[model samples]
Target chain A: MELKGRAHKFGNDVNTDYIISGRHKFKTLDMNELAKYVMEDLDPDFYSKITSGDFIVAGSNFGCGSSREQAPQAIKCAGIGAVLAKSFARIFYRNAINIGLPVVECDTDAISAGDELAVDLSKGIIKNLTQGREIAVKPLPEVMITILNDGGLPAHFRKHGTFNL
Target chain B: MGKTIAEKILSRHSGTETYANEIAVAGLDFVMGQDGTSPLAIRAFNDMGGEKVFDSSKIAMVIDHSAPSPLEGVSALHKLMREFAADKGIKLYDIGCGVCHQLMPEQGHVVSGDLVIGADSHTCSYGAINVFSTGVGSTDLAAGMISGKLWFKVPETFKFQINGKLGRGVYSKDLILYLIGDVTADGATYMAAEYVGEAIDNLSVEARFTISNMAIEMGAKAGLMRADAKTEAWLKAHSDRVSQPVEADPDAVYAKVKEYDASRIGPQVARPHTVDNVSPIEEVEGTLIQQAMLGTCTNGRLEDLIIAAEIVRGKKISPDVRFIVAPSSRQVYLEAMNRGVIQALVEAGAAVVTPGCGPCVGTHNGVPSDGENVISTANRNFKGRMGNNRAFVYLGSPATVAASALNGKITDPRRYVR
Candidate 1:
């Protein structure tokens, strides 16, 4: 599968509280409602600044706090195509994939804010349209691809009646 | 071919000889979710066509994140968790039961060598007792609840060998904060942090819990320690289950190994906006604070409360500060009260709240106002962690928080510890 978007860049250690604050979680659990406040702490107008299918590009250890699914769910709900980072905290990595949000581990130094980019998941390649460069990323394990193809763990379970992987 | 504690446990559970970076599907010994994450897990469970949970006895749900429901929407989510727990015949820890991390071990749901999973990042706290436990998301928790099994990519281990003895004012909180500052937030990403050596061996069970609980802050999958006599004694006091500790092989491979002289470490603190932004007490001292918190899953045990009480005995806190204390559990509350810890704190101008995660997660019961500064014993000092994004949070030991409360500013606890 392939994804195309303009990158929304962030620095290293973009924690979950910064992704979506805990204050919002207490107020509501609705992903769409929470999506309105995604990255509001770091960028006050993040929700209004981007269109659907945009990408959130971050440095190492993205999503490095709380196990709130809302962090990934909010990104997905905000219609982000994927999150590309140098690395991810373990729980956040599992969460993004389990919820059908593609999280790619790639060197994001070549990509800047608002850079047009294309990611081919199966082929493990990232093409930076703005920089005219190509970078390699480690392809996700086969099970994760299967789960994503089935539209997340819930949908995968719905189709298979159990954990297929 | 030697294996670390994590590898051995995973291999035993998966019925395969697993190693680092290898994927294995293992049966879970226990599964847990708190109100913060359980509501979503329940929704995902239903969406996945889940009817009955696999082994209701092995499943637990907690309601500590926002106990007593600060809003109607949150109340509805709590209700959903309650009804789901009831319907599935799972153990439900209602409001005031305390944080899930403390309750799981206190209630005897965890044991060494068990593969446990929770929908809270601090679930790594169980690793203190030698369990190979880690956190997951709501959907992953739901999947584990439904199938009683989950997949894992065995993590490489990073071993921290600490020696010597800590100073009078220094505690495990300072040591862990020092480690975080050294490793940075992501240095141990996707790795199991094995904390062992003379310093760790000398720490109390409660102190070990504090160290393991913040493992997630360093991006570690789990923070583990080999079970010893102290662990056995603690397990015996907490539960009837027999201990099955796992240890790393002498020749076990490690991603990296770090050593420290605990005696040389001073009282440490993690400054605002990020946990890895650390400084010694001398650097951050005299910074004014509006609130001082002494409780959470990290350092809310009886030992912590006792230390705070000792520092504040016969002395009143600064009138400019709002000193809050919330025990991690009812058991801890009862023990503190029995030992006069609660009385000392209350007499010193502290407002002791219920036994749960009060003001730690920023849900309710002490949310700081805008631009305020808070020094807390809880882990994590990210922006908005105390419910207000504009507020600043500094993480420290309970003694430091208590001393700072007395002075209305960040102060060294050593002057008061004696």
Candidate 2:
């Protein structure tokens, strides 16, 4: 798949609590509602600053601590096209893919906030349109690509059938 | 080809040969969700037109994250879980039941050779007992609930060979902290960790549980130990089910192997804001603390409480410190009480709370205010995890917490232990 977006930057170890603090969880579970509070603790004006098709570029362990899938759901519903991080916590990585949120493990050091970029997952290329540079990233396996193509496991299950042993 | 412990268990459940990094479906032996995650799982399950649970007997919901509902929203979520449990006939563990990780093993919901999954990241705690337990998202858990099976990309195993006897001050918590500090948080992402060697073999099941429980700190998919006589005995004592333990093949190939000298390790702690930001206890000694929490699935068992009680026996906590003790489960609480551990702690000015995950998620009971320093036995020292973002949390062993409670500063646990 081909995608283009502006980068939204975050630092290393941007944990689940910072993604969407548990304090707001008491108020609602609505994805959009939770989206409104994403990264509010880190940057109060995060929601106002974001637009559809924006991508998040973060340092290592982007979704560390806590197993709240709400963290990824909020990010995906907030209109993020994809997330490129140095690494991810295992559970958060799985949670993101299960919810059809495209997360890439790539060296995001050269990417800056608001930098225009085009990513071609099919070609394993992340083109920095603003800087005129292209970086290679590992593409998702076919099984995962198929799941993401169907908009996550739920939709995939609806189409194919439940996986049973 | 021989298989690692994780691969063996996955292969067994998948009813086919499995290899590292290969995607396969395995039947689940137990699937669980807590109050925080169950609401979302239930929502996903309902959205998928799930009329009944795949197997109610094998499914469970624990209300421990925000037990007794500190907030109205949490209570509302609890209500939803209660209704769902009743309607689906799934096992329900209500408020004060204890942390899901501790309660699962104590109640025999998880056993050796089982493929268990839960919505809580710490669900990997069951790996201490030789089970292939891993964490999943709510939707993944929902799918597991509906289909009794889940997908996995079998992880390569990192074999950890531990040798040397533990020093007087050293404990499982300290050893795990040292390991995590060396490896960093993302070092083991998407991999299985198989702990072996004389030191691991000599450790108690509780201590092993503590080690395996913190594997997630290094981003491991699961921390596993081979099922030996100790595992079989523990399972026989705790579970009524007759099942064979799973073991790795004699020549199982490991992705990587590393060795450590356990005796060289001293008391350790994870400094504020991140679990892998670790230091020797001496480096952070004398740092003042306002709260000392001794509980959670990590160190809330009977052995841990006894260790705390032994330190606090006939002693008083600092006037500036608020020492809180939370037993892991009702069974643990009752056992400690019967053994006089509760009396020792309470007599030393420690507040004994309900047998649940109190103050771990920052939801209820003993949350630290801004600028407050807290020493705790629970895992995860992330910013704002214990309520205020400004509060500094230091992760340590129960003995370390107890010793620090007495002095209102981080003190060496060895002094008290000796």
Give each candidate's interface RMSD in Å.
0.9, 1.5
DockQ list for all candidates: 0.85, 0.64
Which residue runs does candidate 2 get wrong by more than 4 Å?
A: A121-124
Model 2, position B255, has a per-residue lDDT of: 84
Instruction: Name the candidate that leads on TM-score.
Output: 1
Label model 2 with its docking quality class: medium
**lDDT tens per residue, model 1, B201-292:** 99999999999999999999999999999999999988877778998999999999999999999999899889999999999999999999
Off by over 4 Å in 1: none
TM-score of chain A of 1: 0.95
Error of 2 at A64 (Å): 2.1
- Model 2, A91-155: lDDT tens per residue? 89878988888898888998988899898766788999998898779667677777777778778
Assess each prediction's global lDDT (C-alpha) against the native: 0.93, 0.88
Candidate 1, residue A142: lDDT? 76
Q: Could you tell me how far off, in angstroms, the CA of residue A146 lies in candidate 2 after the best superposition?
A: 1.9
